[model samples]
Target chain A: MNSVYEGAIQDLIDELGQLPGVGPKSAQRIAFHIMEAETEDVERLRAALAAVKTRVKHCETCGNLAEGEQCSICLDPRRDQSTICVIEQAPDVQAIERTHAYRGLYHVLGGAIDPIRGIGPEQLRIRQLLARLQNSEVKEIVIATDPNIEGEATATYLARMLETMNIPTSRLALGLPVGGDLEYADEITLSRAFEGRRIM
Target chain B: MNSVYEGAIQDLIDELGQLPGVGPKSAQRIAFHIMEAETEDVERLRAALAAVKTRVKHCETCGNLAEGEQCSICLDPRRDQSTICVIEQAPDVQAIERTHAYRGLYHVLGGAIDPIRGIGPEQLRIRQLLARLQNSEVKEIVIATDPNIEGEATATYLARMLETMNIPTSRLALGLPVGGDLEYADEITLSRAFEGRRIM
Candidate 1:
């Protein structure tokens, strides 16, 4: 946290350090960058920072980030509202969209269940998801959460709860990635790939 | 410059990308961090960013960054004003201070003579430095610029100018570092060390 700068320069470093993924050294480096940047450029950055808070809002239906009542995905009429691909965060929605494969809607769970982090379904948008599925024509719920331990746990919990509602639940496949060398694969990944082997 | 967020989020990413050292993916990551950060934290960061430009100013005497007429080092009475250590940038001032070995004052050239970048002696604080040395009680001038080619060129240029004024000039040594392994030392560094070998 210690830096050579004082007053405003030091203050900038402190504030930048509070950001996620930014360490003390990175904060100092970035603060210097801001110090040397042109006035117009810095002003633009400040405006963008402030505008994000005022203009961006969470989607009322799927808990995804949006500029209005709904995100771009939720607002699109061409998307299949009957099938919702559930994900853990907004970034996951972006990743799926980049593939240009799925034409369905999305439901952001806000976060996965992490007992260590004290994050549970109660703290997430699970209630909103259940409420959305109540009176809807939704036939399938695609759980596209990350393939990590926490994601798997959340997927299982949601699948069990969704079983009583008679809605078909599907989890993303857990296996070897495309073009991955078998020799370099981890034990658990290799085992999962063996179990989930497809008939070609 | 691609981000998962649309509207305000994408705008935030674009703005953040303008900062030095931050790439497209880093901009997206930082934008997401700002999105998730608490309102108070983001507000504080904004204020700090704005405060830096408004509050910080270049020191009148040495061209170093200062909150007032002079930098803290220049204002201090304990420093040796008779000997001025000339350096390339403000960060060099911090680096020299960390050593606690030299008690002399500093003269920041702002930048070295980089012909490729069109930065020359005329673009630096060389005029101000000469003026300070003219009617003042400065005895020896230590050219403590970096050991790079540009730094050497700047030092030689300053040396030529100061030669007519009869002020003693010196430079930081170029050789093997204290804790560096001999096996990893480059040829140029080894040859320099050989030339500057100390008598046992």
Candidate 2:
């Protein structure tokens, strides 16, 4: 792939190709774009790359990404303290916040339980969540992990752990998404939709 | 888009979104990936970005990206300098080189004629190409601009300009792409394929 391009350009393309979604062609396109882009824009990207790692750290309480010891959600006095929404990662917290629905505090588990990937209950921040619950007067827990296999496994594990704590625990309902046709829905989703149906 | 994440994370996401083909969702995903990536990887990307701008410069002779005054292709003595393959940009030079078909030298015109973007013949390195031709014993010119409107226009403009030079000039053939289904070929492509048909 670096056969034709010269020294610096080839190096840049190789680095860009290492990104998650960027392929060889896209890496070449981006490297060319950067070559043609304003110096200021490139400098900004470099600065952002440098700042993301050096300035950001995990929240001490929730394990969410934070600038200091605690994340903004943990520091906010206006947010509900009686309930905690347990999720897989910081991006999940961002997604829930975008809906403007959940106002309660959040607990990031870092990742879900996937034995194939060597991730288990001990590998996650479940103990930290339990410790936080013990210290706080939380009355309810919402397990908002993804609807996938790993997420489901994590939710079940967390539910079993929280059952003896006497606090009410719930999982987010799974059903057909809005604006989706019932005829096109997959069997699993359709079954869930039917099982979770409410009398209107 | 930056509603939830803290300073450094939000800044990284914003910068990532500015890249070509990268949307806000992808930006967030990549930013988080970077956040979780090893320090060595992040440092490699930063070094690449910094070195690309500082070390790379346009080829003084052909307008292609080069580490020194001239591009590798321009400096190579084994390449066929008598036949110069004229292309729209440096990436086109790369695409042609990847085929391992042509051994001729290349002349990059920077970009095709784009009136909507206010680019004209003077904006490109056309004069440099003409000067090179006048000073050299070149025999042929291959117009390998893109098959799009701007590329055709640029080819036509160059052909008219090169007519007096008496050097044989040719354009790349237009037809259905290899491995592409004939049924899915567009009307314009089908018409061109017929117009440019060759005898076995």
Candidate 3:
């Protein structure tokens, strides 16, 4: 709103509103707070915005983000080199890590194949991933993309691509979430839960 | 969560999380977006943040945010000087303006008298507002603070202080919102609605 706000404050609000998930009202509130904030505090935030862009880069080998050429996981010696987790984005890497269940190197695809958005296999990091697998002794690849239509499509394509390569590939199982009520489960999820049922 | 993020990126997340409504998860997401944003876009945001801090300041007369010594409202000769609307904060001015109503001068209190948070009248612009009232032809004052405890307290205090000045005072009426459903109305609101019933 034009209101009586100065040009500088309005410009700040416009800039903040461009951030994902921050709408117009939130941007205005944030601009006012930043204006009233301590000089050192705003400076710290400014430095961070500048530093992240300058310091962070994609890990050349795996397509995940990194400060240098290789991500921390790729540089770590203890992670399993024989198995690699394939994820859609760098943030997905963080989500999987929080589970503390995986201890292998990761390959970030940057995004999944979605023809609706004009994104296809060639647009992703699939070529780089194939290159990583060619000379490596990796025996297994875990496709950890979301269970949506696009994610499944990507996983199926990758599985087919690796069939001749002889490296076994698997997808994350679809099931009812733990601690969730069966009544609240959607139809497709219920069917998937049945399909994935075990003898126990 | 730090996960595999570099130090600078993590610092950025922390700084962003300190903003009013942003949590750690949102902060992380925003930081990543900032890192991936175009250099020109990020520079514009940075400049806006810096300029707001350097150029925006409080209006000397009304305590509202201003680029110059006095706010636009104060400088506008068309505004009615006989009627002054007292509000809790500068943003309140915008809210009132958006209503397309009220064309009088405004006095910003900076904040209400919040004792638990250690804020008092002395912390506000009460003295300046009082000085503006002196030897002026102002006929009425509208105490448009919030309807919450602190706002009501401030309004009551201001009304009592202005009683000797013989100028009429008023508050924003509390009632059911225009499009709100009466079925889902809370008790306090329902009572307010009943109390504020108007004759046809």
Candidate 4:
């Protein structure tokens, strides 16, 4: 509790507790760790925080995190310009990039379509994605949103919007994970795996 | 992972990962959360970090965390100065204070003696504790070190040193935790529980 610590220590603990997933005990541990850490290390962390706020910006074209007007993926000429993968956050782009299987451009939706939270199609970057499609020589649209309810809703909404445009669109396949055991798969995933089964 | 993010974002993730219990995935998640957070929130965290480093100082007498020359416990006249509870770190002092059962003074040794880690009595604040004993009207010493090997070793060493001083010295009892199941209690704890059973 704040009462247990002095002014600065309590303040640090309170601030650290505000971060996602960091509870009060964890915040206390972290605060003490920082207090014991080298001055240079604390300065580096502070500098990084300041730099992220000042230096990083969103790509005007795709809404992905970037250093300049466009992100590294959007700026690179080697990435496939004919295909654009749409997804819910900048981190999703990073996750897809880790696989190295896809070399296409990405459109970050900023967030998903959640009716309860009042996040609709307009809250996302759907308009920018459509604008990119209209001017560019893009051939295929890949909906790479998450497989959850909100992501599925967003993907369905995007699919309906693109139906009249005549461009071939696809969604990421849903099935049992690569390394997961069959017995451990949930009912939804088991059904999806069965439906998407193919002959070798 | 650093390759996936821009300069500042990657740096923030790397710094966050250095904290105790935070893995790479958690670091990334926190970094993104910070990126999306309001500017004022980020500034508050930074300010707290800076303030903690600049303001927090160890108590001159007991080595507990303090704002000035002495900690609040050391400065409080209502607390019993006749008894001193000697513990490992400042956090341990906080843990003991939370119970409200002990109303005496505290001496923080900074850490217990671990010979394997090259941390001996010299590394801790044992000398300062002895110095406090020379002038103070302290009648008893309560060793509240952790129950691990290092803590036990430190307590034994202190007891041997204090044996010649004609002062009463004791240790905190060790037994099964209050809410722990008897079947799940470890062998040493169960043995300690049996050894510590009172007549009542």
Top candidate, metric DockQ: 2
Per-residue alpha-carbon lDDT of model 4 for A73-157, expressed as tens digits?
8999999999999989999988999998999999999999999999999989999998998867889899999899999999999
lDDT of 3 by residue, A1-200 (tens): 66357699989988998998898888989988998999889988898899888898989999777889998899999999999999998989888888889999999998999999999999999999999987799989999988999999999999999998889998889999999999999999999999999997
Candidate whose lDDT is highest: 4
lDDT of 2 at A158: 90
DockQ of each: 0.67, 0.79, 0.75, 0.77
Clashing pairs in 3: none
Chain A of candidate 2 gets a TM-score of: 0.97
What digit string (tens of lDDT, one per residue) describes model 4 on residues B114-184?
A: 99999999999999989999977999999999999999999999999888887789999999898889999
Which residues of candidate 2, in runs, are more than 4 Å off? none
lDDT of candidate 4 at residue B174, scale 0 to 100: 96
lDDT tens digits by residue: candidate 3, B7-77: 77788888999998898888989988998899899989989989999999999988888899998888999
**Model 2 lDDT per residue over B58-135, tens place:** 888888888899988889999988998899988998889889989998889989999999999999989999989987
Q: Give the C-alpha miss distance for residue B70 in model 1, angstroms.
A: 1.6
TM-scores, chain B, all models: 0.95, 0.97, 0.95, 0.97
Residue B4 in model 1: shift from native, Å? Answer: 5.0
Cα lDDT tens digits for candidate 1, B2-85? 355778999998887766667777777888788878888889999999999788888999877799989888898999989999
The stretch of ten residues in a row with the least summed lDDT in candidate 4 chain B is B1-10
- Candidate 1, chain A: TM-score against the reference: 0.96
The whole-model C-alpha lDDT of candidate 4 against the native structure comes to 0.92
